[model samples]
Target: MTQLTQNNGQIKNNYCVIDLETTGLDNLTDAIIEIAVIKFDLDGISETYQSFVNPGREIPPFISDLTGIFDKDVLVAPEFNSIIPKLKEFIGDSILIGHNVGFDVGFLREFGFNFEGTIFDTLDLSYVIHPTQLDYSLTGLSLF
Candidate 1:
């Protein structure tokens, strides 16, 4: 584990960043259509994994517009089940980090990817790092 300075103090960390593009906001009803995960050491992205998942449903128009991932794009792609083994291997013993991690974690949990590692939400972290900033979105943080 690597020690990263947390708000309280230094924390031992084994970090991986995850970002999932889903069909919608409701985890109970929506599904993941694209997944991106990258393992990071102090240097940076040492390993990466990404895939388009077939959600078994139409990619909603707005979602397609936003993601540029239409139904046709994933028609022949493997679904979530096939992706799990590799994902588990890549994420072993690593803390998860993301811009809004809860949303990704919720969707992933619903699909049975039981990740029992520490989760660090950058949005939450931003509150401690840039407390006075008006926007905490990734783009906003980038502009700082």
Candidate 2:
């Protein structure tokens, strides 16, 4: 477990930065194809939770190219409902952070997890902290 500053600067304990790759952009229409969560200590990535999900929908061609995940690849994987318990266990009481956390958080919430924790958006934060910088994508930030 680790701690980080929240959106309001209050100390948030047990920080977990999460990311999700899905069938499509819409959480209502699509499903989580792959999920990655890396727990962070003060120094960096401490623990991780990553899995492929069988979305039960045909993977769109564009998405397959984007994430390198094909429908056949996850055909044998667990469904979203089946994996919620494990996801919850991994995220227990961690303050969640991500590039566009709402997307990942929204997906989790749709699967019936309350997801009670402080959320900090590095994307939104970057806009405030360094508006002059062009790209604030998670990969871009990692490069810097």
Candidate 3:
């Protein structure tokens, strides 16, 4: 387990940044199609994992267009069940950081992964730190 620390109010190390590309927004109805995780420490990224998951359903046209991940792309990819163990191993007990972490956490919970570690949400933090900003979406924040 990696320990989380702060130096002069700045995050030090031992965090996992995760992102998921899903078929839709509804966690109960949608499915995860692609997932990526990068574990980083003070030195730099220590581990990285990424994979496309077969959602067992057709990817909606809008989602396919936005993500460039069509049904055909994941036709032979591993299922979510098969990916869970590896994901759990990669995350371990590191603090999780994501754009809108609650959404990701909801999807993971629906798939039966109980992530007990701390989570840092860039979306929520951005709202607090940049209250006047017009957008808090990941892309918006990135551009800002």
Report lDDT (CA) for all predictions: 0.88, 0.83, 0.88
Give the C-alpha lDDT of model 2: 0.83
Say which prediction, candidate 2 or candidate 3, comes out ahead on TM-score: 3
lDDT by residue (1-144, candidate 3, tens digit) is: 445554335444588999999999998999999999999987889999999999999999999999999999999999998988999999986889999999999998897788887888888889999998997887788788
TM-score of each: 0.88, 0.85, 0.90
Where is model 2 poorest over a 10-residue stretch in terms of lDDT? 1-10
Task: Rank by TM-score, highest first.
Answer: 3, 1, 2
> Model 3 lDDT vs. the true structure?
0.88
- Show the lowest summed lDDT stretch of 10 residues, model 3: 1-10
Q: lDDT by residue for model 1 over 58-141, one digit each (tens)?
A: 999999999999999899989998899999999997778898899999998999898887788989989999989998888889
Candidate 3: residue 28 Cα off by (Å)? 0.8
Best by TM-score: 3
